[model samples]
Target: MDKQEQALGLLQAAVESMGGQVRPGQQEMVKHVVEALDEERHLLVQAGTGTGKSMGYLIPALAYAQTSPKPVIVSTATLALQSQIVGRDVPRLLESLKGKLSRPMDVSLLKGRSNYLCQYKLGGGYPDEDEGALFSMDEKPPASGTVYSPLANEVMKLREWAEHTETGDRDELVPGVSDKAWRQVSVSAMECLGSQKCPMADECFSEMARARASEADVVITNHALLAVSAFEGLNVLPDFDVAIIDEAHELQDRVTSSVAGALSARMVLTAAGGAKRHCAVNVDELTKAAHRLEKSLTGIPTGLMDKGLPEEMGIALNDIVEQSRLVLALTKPEANAPADGGRQTARSQLQAIMDDAIRMLETEERREVLYTTRPREFVDGRGYVESDPGTPATLNVAPLSVAGKLREGLFDGRTVVLTSATLAIGAQFDSVAGSLGLMGAGAPSWEGVDVGSPFDYPKQGILYVAKHLPKPGRQLSAETLDEIEELITASGGGALVLFTSKRSAEEAAEILRPRLDAEILCQGEGSMKSLVEQFAADRDSCLFGTMTLWQGVDVPGDSCRLVIIDKIPFPRPDDPISKARTEDIARHGGNGFMQVSATHAAIRLAQGAGRLIRSVNDKGVVAVLDSRMATARYGTFLKGSLPPMWPTVDKKTILGVLKRLKP
Candidate 1:
C-alpha cells in the first residue's frame, strides 16, 4: 500500500490495540495534515477535545519524516503539551509503528537553554547577589538579607542529581524544584556562553539536545523556542521542512512574550553585583545609574509610552547603557583570572544583562511598543510599585504585532498546520487567521477545516446563562454569589469556577466556603498542579481560580460537573499593550472592540466552558453568571464560540439538571 494508506492502517491498528476506534475528527485531521505536507501548503485545523489530535498529527508527520530529508518540527504552546507529545505520544507512536514504518523515526524534544541545568552555572559560584545565595556558604551573605533553608536543601539535592542524571533536564527532578531554586542552577539563552567558549561544552545539556534535534527525523519544541528561532532569526533550532503548531490559539501570546524585553532596577543591581565580584569593577557607578533610572521612572505614571518618554527618563536609560558598557569593557578577564566556571559564568551573566539593557534602550523600532508598569506577584496578584520603598517600575518593550513576522518567517516556503480546539471564534477562523498574520494580501493561500468533536455536546452538557441576574458590575455581586452557592449546593460540589481576576476569585471563594457543604480550593492556596490533583482526587470539591484555570485545567469524570464563569473575560482597561493594539486596529479601519476585545473574551469563554464534558461519558453544566451573555447584542457572537450544548436561562431548569447529575 502507499504511504498514506499504510499510515492510516497503522493508526487504525494502534487505536484498536488501545481498545478504541479511530475517531472521525482524528481521521479528518490526519488526512488534512498529510495533504498539507504533500503540497507544501498551509492548513488550519481546529480539532476539538477528545479528537486525539496529538496522534492525528504525529502519525502523518512521522510517516512523512520517515522518507523526507528534513525533519518535521512540532511546536506546542505549553510545556505540558510538549512533555505530553514527547514523553507519551511520540513513544507510543514509535512502539506502534516499529515494523510498519518505511524507515526509522527518531524524535527529539528541544527546550530553551533555561529548561536544562547549566553545569557551568552549577559548578561555578552564582553571581554575588544572584538567586544562588543558598549555595554559597563560603562567601559573604547575600545582600537581600533573607535566608531560605528549604532552598539550601533543594540546591544540594539538585547537585547530587546533577552528578548522576544523564539528561540534566530540570523536569526530570523528582518533585520538581521551585522556580526560585531552579534559577540558582540554570542559565537562560542570553546568559549562556557560546558552547565553543565553555569548558563544559561537551557535556552541555542544551547543546546536546540541539545536536540530537539536528539529526532526528522529528523535533518537538515549544512556541517560545520556535518564536526565537523564526522571529528573532536565532539558529537554535534545526531547519525543518514543515511545522505543526499545536495549541495554535496561544501562539500569538506566546510569541509576544518571547520577543518582549524588560529593564528593572532589581536587574541592574544584580548585574552590577556580578560585575563587582568577577570584574572587580566598582559597583557604585552602576548603582548610581540604576538609582537615576529608578527615580526617573517613579515620577512617570504607569502606562504605555506611545507618545514619548520623559527627557530625563531617556537620559537615565542612556546613562545606564553607557555605564554597563564601560563596566563590561573595564572588567575584561585578567591574564591570571581564576579558570573556575564561577568566574566565567559570572562574566557571561554580566555581559548578557548589559546586552539586554542596550536592547531595552532601542526605541526607534516603530513596530514595537514601550510601557512602564508595576510587576505583580504571580501567586497573589499583588502589585509592587515604586512607592513601596525599594520596588522599582519596569520598562517593557514588545512587538505590537507578530503577524507580519510570523507570516514572513514561519509560513513562507514551509508546510504549516495550525491546530487548536479554540481556533474558531464566533464560528469562524478569520479572526484567528488574521491575528496570526495569515490573512493579508500576498499572504500564502491557506485553508481551514474544523473537524467537529466526537462527543455529543448537546447530549452531554448544558449551557446555562443567568438571564434573570443583574448586569455584572466591577465585582461579583451578592446575588451572583448566592446563585453560585446554590449551583454548587445543587451539584454537591464538583464545580470549577473561573474568574477574570484574583480578587474576584478570592471573594467568591470566601463567600462560598462558609455556605457550601463541600471543600472550596482557591488558586493561591497551592501550586496549580497540586490544587488540580487535590481537586481531582476529591470528587466533591470545587476549584476557584483566575485565568490559568480557564485554559490549563483538565479534570474529567465526575470530579468536574459544573463550570461557572463569573463574568466575560475582557482585557483590563488599563492593560497598555491591549489598549494600544486596539487603538492601532481602529486606526487601520478595523472594529477594535470586536477584533481585539470580543474575540479574546470569546476564546476564553469557550475554554472556560470546555472544562465541562471533557470525555464522552462526562456530563456537566456550564453556567455563565454574566447576564450580558443573554442581554447584550454581542451575546450571540460569544455564545456561537462555545460548544453546541443544550442551552437554558431558567434557573430552575439548571438547578434540577445539576441535582440529577450529583453523586
Candidate 2:
C-alpha cells in the first residue's frame, strides 16, 4: 500500500481500538501528513476539534520513523495536551498497530534537563552560590543563628527518595515540594557540571533520559524545550529530521521566551555573590555596581525602552559591563588547573550577566527588542511610589522577529508538519505561517490544508454578541455585570465566565455570588483542576476565571451550557512587547494594529469561544459582552476566526434561548 493508504489504514485501526468512528477530517489529515513527511515539505494543517488529529499524525510518524534512520519529534504547547498524548493517545495507537510494523515502535517522553534530577547536585558535589546553605540534614532552623546548620527537613526527605527511585524524575515524586526546595536538589542544564568533570557521571538521570530518546522511534517534548534546542542551539532533545508541532500557533511566543535574556538587581547580586572568591579584583567593586544599577532603576517608569534607557540607567549598565569584563579577565584559571566546579560555574554566571547587560543597550541591531518591567504588584493589586523602589525594575531583551532565525535554523533543514485546530485564522494560514517562517518573501515553500471539524457548529452552539453594552475600560462596567447575572440566572448557573484580567474576574465573582443562586467558584479561590472538575460535575455551578480558562479546558455536556466573555481578549495596551512590535511594524509601513493587536485578539477570542463546545453533542451559547465584536469594522475579521456558531445580537432572544437551555 502507498504511504497515504498505509497511514489511513493505521488510523482506522487506531480509531476502532479506541472505540471511536473514523472521521473524514482525520483521514484527510493523515493523508496530508504522510505526504508531507515523505516529500520532505513543510505543511500546515488546521484540523478542528474532534478530528482525532493526534492519531492522524502519529500513524504517519510511526510509518516514517520505521523507514528513516532518524527518530520523529512531536512538540506540544501545553502540559495537558502533552499528558493526553503520552498518557493516552500514543499508547492506544501503538496497541492497534502492534505487530503490523517491521518492529515495535518506542515512544519516549523527553523533558528538559531541569525536569530530571542531577546526580552531581544531589550528591553535594556542587551547590549554586545562592543555595550553598542546602544539603544540611538538620531538622530544625539554626538555633540563635549559630554556625552549626543542617540539611533542611524537606531536602532530607528528597535525599531519602533519591536513594531508591529508578528514573530520578521530579514528576515521579508525590506530594511535591516547593520550587525553593527542589532547586536545592536539582540543576538546570547550564548549572550542572558535565559528565567529564562530575564524579556522578555514571547513571545520570538526565543522561539516561537522553539515551532513551536517542534510541526511541518517537520523541515527545513541549514547545519550550523545542524552542531552546531549535533556536537557542541547546541540546535539550535528541536530534531528529522531522518535527510535528501540535500547537503551531504558540511557537513564536515560546521561542521568544527561550532566547530572551533579562537583567535585574537580583541577578546582579547573585552573580556578584558567586564570583566573589574567584574574582582577581576586589569583589567590592561588583557589589558597588549592583547598588548603582539599583539606584538607576529606581523611579524609572516601566514599559518598552524603544527610544533608550534613562541616562543614569545607561551609565550604570556600562559600569556593570566593564566591571564584569575586568573580573572575567582577572579570574581565568590556569590551563592545567584542577577542575573546580564552583569556579567554573561562577565564571559562567558572570559571563551571562555581562552579555545581557550589554544587550540591554543594543540599538544598532533592530533585530532585538528591549523593555523594562515593574516589580510585581502587592497581593492587593496595588503599588506605592517608594523612594527606594523596594525591588529594582528589570531590563529585558528579546528577538524582535524570530522568523528569519526559525527559517534558517528549523524549517529550512527539516521536514516539518504543524497542526492545530486554530492554525488557520480567518480561514487563512498566512499569519501563522509568517510567524513560523514558512511564508513571506524568500521563505521556504509550504502548503496549508484545512480539514473541517466533525461537529456541526451552526447547530451545536450560538454566538451571542451584546452590541449595546458599554466598552470595557479602566473600570468594570455595571451593564456588563448585569448582562452576566441575567444570563447566569436564565441558564440556571451552568456558566463559564472568561475575563480579560484576573482582577476583573474576581470583581465579577464578588458581585455575582450573592445575587445568583448557583455556587460561584472563583479561579484563584481553588486549584484550576479542582475548580474545573467541580464546575463540570455540578450543572448549577459557575466558574469565573481569566486567561487560564480560555484554552486547554474541556467541559463537554450540559454542565457548560453558557460561555460568557467579559471582553475581547486583546494584548494589554501597555504590554512592552506588544508596543515594541507594533511600533516596529508601523515604522515599516504596515498596519500595526491590524497585524499585531487585532490578530492577537482574534486568536484569543476564538480560543475563549471554543470553551463552549467540546463534543458533537455539546450545545451552548458563547456570549461576548463587548459591543466592538459586532460594530467595529474589524469585527468581521475577528468573528471569522471563531467557530461558525449560530449568530445573534438580540439580547431578549438570547436570554429566552438561555432560559430554554436551562438544565
Candidate 3:
C-alpha cells in the first residue's frame, strides 16, 4: 500500500489501541484530511468532539513532515491544547511512530516572550529598582522553613533553574504560576530587547525557544502569536511551510485582536512619565495628549458604536493623535545610551498604535465605526475604557470581506489548514468562509469534510432544553431558576452551570448554593486554573461562570458529568461590534439575526456542549436551559450548532441518565 493508505492503517491501529471506536464517517474524514493535505490545498475539517482528531491530523502532519524537510506548525487556541500536543501527544506519538517514518522527527513549542521568565527580571534589572516594593515576594517571608520563602525567593529559584531549562518555558515549571505572577518575571514582545542587545543574550528563554523551533521538524504555538507573525509581521515564529490551526473557528477573532491595539489614558500617562524618567520627551505635550485622548475616548459609547463615526469626536482624537506623534517624534534615540533602548521601543509602540488609529479613522467602509467610554469611573479623575467584561471592548470592522487582504498578507505566501470541531456553524460554510474573505474566485479553492466523533452522541449525551421558560432578552425568569435547581440536583454536583452574564452566574450561584450540597465555585473566585483544579480535585464541585468558561475550559472524565447552559448564549443586544456586524449583514439583505447573533450563539452553544465529552471514556448531559433552543424556529439553527447530542425534553430521563454517571 502507498504511504497514505499505510498512514490511515497506523491511525486506525492507534485509535483501536487507545480503545477508541472510530465511526465510519470519522474514518472517511481521516482519509479525506490526509488527501487534502497531500494535495497542498486548503481544507476546513469539522471534527466534532470525541473524534480522534488530534491523532487524525497529527499522523498526516507528521508523515508529511517526515519525508519533507519543511516544518509544520500546529496552532491551537488555548495553552491547554498546546501543552497537550507538546508534552503529551508529540512524545507519545514519537515513541509509537518509531521506525515507521523515513527519518527522525523533532517537535518544539513556541510562545510569545511573555510566556518565558526574563532572566533580567529574575536577576534584578527591572525598570523599577525598588524591587522589594514592586514585587511583594521580597517584602514577605515564605511560610517558614519552606524552600520558597519570599515570592522573590520563588522567582530566584526559578531563575536559577532556568540555567538548566532546555525548553525555557514557564509551563514546564513544577508548579504553574498565575498570569499576574508570570508578568512579574517575563517581558512582553514590545518590552523585550533583541538577543544582541539583551544582557542575557546567551541564556534568553525566548531565544532558546526560537533556536529550538528552528531545529525542530514540528512546532506548536497559539493563534495569537501566529496571527501576530502573519498579520503584524513580527517574525516571532520560525519559518514553516504549512500551519494547522486546530481551533480554526476562533482564528478571525484572534487575528483581529492581535492587529487591534488599545491604549488607556492611564497606560499612556504611565508610559510617558516612565519614559521621561529615563528618556527625554515633551512631557507637557505628552500629558496634554493623554488628557485629550482620555476625554475624546470618554465620549464614545461602550459595546457596539455602530452610530456613524462622530465628526466632533473624530476631530478631537485627530488633535490628540497629532500631539502624540509629535511627542514620539521628539524623543529621538541616542546611540548606545541607556535610555536609548527604552526611547526607541516606546517610539515604535506609540507610532504603531497611532498608525492603527489613523487607519481606523481613514477606512471608508460605512459599516466601520468607533466609540469611547470609561470602563470604570473613579472618584478622582481615574477612569478606564468600558469594554464588555465578558468580551474585549473592541472596535470591530469587517472590511466587507477579509479575503483580499488575507490572501495578500497571510495565505498567498504559504499553505494554510483550518480545522475545527465547529467551523461551519449552519451546515453551510458561507457564514465562516465569508467572514474570512474566502468567498471569492478560484483564489485557493476550499473543500470541507466532517470527521464524526467516536462517542454515539445520541446515546452518550442528552440535550435538555427548558421549553416552558420565557425568552432571555429580558431579565431571566423565576422558572429558569427553578429549572436550574432541579437540573443541578439531578446532575448532583458535577456540573458547569454556564451563564450568558456574570450577574446571572452570581445570582445562580447564590440560589444554588443554598439548595445544592456540592461545593460552589464561581468564576470571580479565582483564576481559571485555580477553579479547574478545584473542580477536578472534587467531582462534587459545580462551577458557575460566564462566556469565558464556555470555550477555553476542558474537564474530561467524571469530574464534568453535566454541562448546564443557563441560557442561549446570545450576543448582547447592545454589543457595539455585534450590532454593527448585524447591521452589515442586514444591509446585504441577509437575516442579520441568523448571520450574526444566532451564529455567535450557535458557536458558543457548541462550545458549551463540547465541555461535556473531552475524552473517549467521557460522557455527560448538555442542558441548554433556553426554551428557544427547542420552541423557536431558529432553535433548529442553534441546535445544528451543537454536537449531535441525543435530544430529550423529559426531565426524568435526563436526571436518571446523569445520576447513573459519576458525580
**TM-score for each of the candidates:** 0.93, 0.94, 0.87
- Tell me the tens digit of each residue's lDDT in model 2 across 1-663: 888888787777777777889799999998999999888899999988888788888889998999778889999987667867988888877888787788888998888778787777766666543545564545544576564333465676687888899888777788667677777778777666676766677878988888889999999888888878767787778788899998887888878888899988778887788778554456778788888888877677777886777788788888889989988887887766665666766888888889888877775464788777765543554322223344567888888888888898778789999998888877898888887777678988888999989999999999999999977786578999999999999999999999998778888888889899999999889878899999999999999998889985788999999999999887988888778888888999988898888988888888888888889999989999999998999999999999999999998999999999997
Q: Candidate 3, residues 1-663: lDDT per residue as tens digits?
A: 876797787676666656666566566666776777777777788888766577777887887777766678899987878998888887877776667777888888898888887777666555532335235445344576655435545555565666687766887887765555566677777667667567777877788888888888889999888877766667888777787889888877676666554555665666567567656655676667666656655535565455544665465446557766776767755556452344545665666546655655665642244443335432322222244443223333334334455666666756777788888766777777766656767466778767666667777777888776777655557888888777777767888888888777876787678887888999988988899889978887889898889886778878889888888878777765567667777887989888778888888788888999887677788887777888899999888888777888888887788778754
Would you give me the overall lDDT of model 3? Answer: 0.72
Considering lDDT, where higher is better, how would the candidates rank from best to worst? 1, 2, 3
RMSD of 2: 3.1
For model 1, the stretches where C-alpha displacement exceeds 4 angstroms are 125-148, 282-286, 331-364, 377-391
- Pairs in clash, predicted candidate 2: 136-150, 136-151, 137-151, 138-150, 138-151
> What local lDDT does model 2 show for residue 423?
81
lDDT of each: 0.84, 0.83, 0.72
Query: Candidate 1 or 2, higher TM-score?
Result: 2
Using lDDT, give the best candidate's number. 1
Name the best candidate (by TM-score).
2
Model 3, position 449: C-alpha lDDT score: 69
